[model samples]
Target chain A: MTYINSFRTGLKEGLPICMGYFSVSFAFGIFAVESGLTVWQTVLISLFNLTSAGQLAGVPIIASGGSFVELALSQLVINSRYSLMSVALGQKLSREVTLPEKLFIAYGNTDEIFAVSVSNEGEIGTRYMAGLILLPVLGWTGGTLAGAVAGNILPAIVASALGIAIYGMFIAIVVPIAKKEKATALCVATAILFSLAFKYVPFLSFVPSGFTIIISAVIASVIFAIAAPIKTDEEEQSNG
Target chain B: MDNGKFFIYLLVMAGVTYLVRMIPLTLIKEKIKNRFVLSFLHYIPYTVLSAMTVPACFYATGSTLSAIVGFVIAIVASFFERTLIQVAALSCAGVLVTELIMNYV
Candidate 1:
């Protein structure tokens, strides 16, 4: 009963995430097919990668006959934050979680799962996180398959425009939190400024997109940490 | 990349990604105690999401004006703490309206 309830809750909580994943993954599928990948290959990549940005960055390299090392480094640069997210999640999880369960849950860690899990209270068990993971993975995979099957049916302009859904989803996730939290707002502003600097500045213009994202995130995180460290217990208690 | 080699590369990449995510949990029995590290971990999602979204909002439509309109709409909608769907719908609608009016006038 507990497992069933957790699954139900996960499904409900994950609906919006699933919708966002579907749209973005669908776009990826369309792009993959147009890039000359077969349906099976596209589906397999989505299932294994489960990362929009990483896949987007990698697809060009793969098409261009880039080396495996280049592909791996690009993926590492883009998806390195998942390591941080996983560590945070590991801290939130019960210490008693078995090795196998931890391994399984780690595979399922994505932006959506991390957001939903971290926002919830208390020690999150593997069971509940698993419920959250399964839904989005399935949604993403299914959506990719659908997109590949329906490839190029829509006009190129429309399909290209729909790619903006990924950005829309990111905005929906960040804007609300930034509005309420000063630390988050600062982090957002710093990241944007640094990203623009990397893009527009003559010397920085040569930096790759994947590296730019990683560097901006690191710089923003550091600045926010220095400027606004977490409040102490006495401060919190006094305020309360 | 040939078909066989591409699949092989993907399998290796997936294995490496999974290992990077899982190894710390499996090996590190002690809790993370460093405050700076913990705080950095706490802020990664926020920083990454913001980094992705901010530029995207401004650049997604290939014009600074559209991005500003989209950001304004998204910011207002997000203040209400609405669901992702609602925020996305409202922002897209906002972008379309802004673009249409710009074109007509």
Candidate 2:
């Protein structure tokens, strides 16, 4: 793809991800501020971190004066899946994308960004990646700033309503795939079962939410991966 | 924690997260060959999102009934393949409307 064409395609594809991030990060801003983070601190978290779940998990740790080791471990555990995604995405980059650009692109490789980038046909270029990352970053930081400032001013009804927006987006992403694939449906169902066990089971309920997510995801994926592994070379075969 | 300490924490958090994303993309030029691992990675996003959504989404709206209403609305919208923003907005609207009705009652 030429630079302008690649960048424009990226901006077009990134629009939805940008909008999705706005609502989710907006909720994060309010939640973080409510959990005792300053507005600036909350906004800065969104600006630099960019991972919603990680930032959401990190705020409480920071607020409570948790140890650095505790913070780092939590972040690693919560964000480890990104390593897999980055590896998957790396193979898709066009050769014109340099080492430094890859490093910068890696910074914005959130789940949605990775999904959008990897689903595109052929090699992904530097400008395309840059364009794709731009709006979501802006939306994330801007939404956090807006939500932190509006936390007090927004009525209880509106504030509470926004809480479900992120979950709605999550459902939007997963449900469509689950609908199309039986294996995905089974994986999601199993994960939900594990998630509920962690929430309600005695003793198990004490596990931190971040760890709960990782454990559930790992177990569910393992079961399905063993029972119904996808072709490893599936990506190389353009189905068209 | 003080500002300096907080900044340090944020830096560590960002650094760890960034490295998790950066190192693999920068270093791993070859496509993963392991079938199990590829399948695991392929399934991870859905599983993680599912695990996160459930139980937590039930408590999201602060009222279980409204949360359920929103959840159902989101699921239906998504089942119909609505855009991400459309599903999110519909669900939020559903929750807000439900809350308003509950309050009036």
Candidate 3:
């Protein structure tokens, strides 16, 4: 596809993500504020971070009066998945994708953007990713701004219900991919079981939420790689 | 949280997040030649998203019952290849209605 066409398609394909983010980040706004962050601080967090889980995870630590060490470590563990996503996206990126572009685009490389970019039919370029990331960034940050301003105004029932929307987006990413590949199905199951084990096991219970995510993801991916290495040629067809 | 400490918190969170995304994209210049390593990278997307989800989704909302109800709706809707918005809207509605009913109970 031409750059402009790919760029437009990227934006069009991203509409659902934008809408979903608005609702989800709206909840984040409320959470941040209810947790005692001023509206500007909440919006500032969204503006710079653009993360759902990391922000959700961190704001509470601050509200509960946790230390900087706890917050930083939590961030490193919860968001370490982005490093894996970055490597995966780096593979699909056009050679013309430059240092400056990579630097800017890297900030927008959340789960949804990575999913949308890799699944595209043509060479993934900067313009396309920029288009893809733009609206969601707006939706994510804008939603937070709205929520920060009027978060407490919403009825408790409504505000809490909106909380589930982001998790819904997470499910949307996994299901379609898993349906197409048994290896992926196995990987997801392993992740779920591992996450549950960490959550429920008494001794392992102290493993914080961030570390639990890192460990589950790394183990599942590593095991899948060793057990079922796709031939390089077969990779193209299987991935699509 | 004071403004200064809040900024420090935001700085760490934003900085580490950016570093994670930047390091692999900027540092990894060539195709990973190792097959095992290549496979690992290939599977990371699916695994990481899945791992992050699970237990988290089931606890996304206040009411565990309503959250499970929403979680199940999401999985089923997405399984049928429903669009993301459709799935999210459906699940969110599911949570809202479930919570509404439970509130009355």
Better of 2 and 3 by TM-score: 3
lDDT tens digits, residue span A126-198, model 2: 8888889999999899899999998788888888998998899889889898999999999999999999999
**Model 2 residue B84 distance off true place after TM-score fit, in angstroms:** 0.9
Per-residue lDDT, model 2, residue B5, is 81
Off by over 4 Å in 3: A1-5, A234-240
For residues A68-163, write the lDDT of model 3, one tens digit per residue.
Answer: 888888888889889888988887787788999999989999998888787765568888888899899999999999998998789988887898
Assign candidate 2 its CAPRI class.
medium
**Residue pairs in collision within model 1:** none
Query: Could you list the chain B TM-scores for each candidate?
Result: 0.71, 0.89, 0.86
Fill in the DockQ of model 2: 0.76
Per-residue lDDT of model 2, residues B2-84, tens digit only: 67887898899999999999999999876668898888878887888889898999998859999999999999999999988
lDDT of 3 at A190: 93
**Quality of candidate 1 docking, DockQ:** 0.51
Instruction: State the lDDT of candidate 1 residue by residue for A1-240, as single tens digits.
Output: 011227667777777877778877887998888787778888888899888888877777776667888878878887887877887888777765788888888888888678878777556777777778887898789989989999678655445445566677777777777787888788878888898888889999898877787789889888777777665435566999
Cα lDDT for residue A36, model 2? 88
Candidate 3 residue A166 C-alpha distance from true site, Å:
1.0
lDDT of 3 at A63: 82
DockQ score of each predicted structure, in the order shown: 0.51, 0.76, 0.77
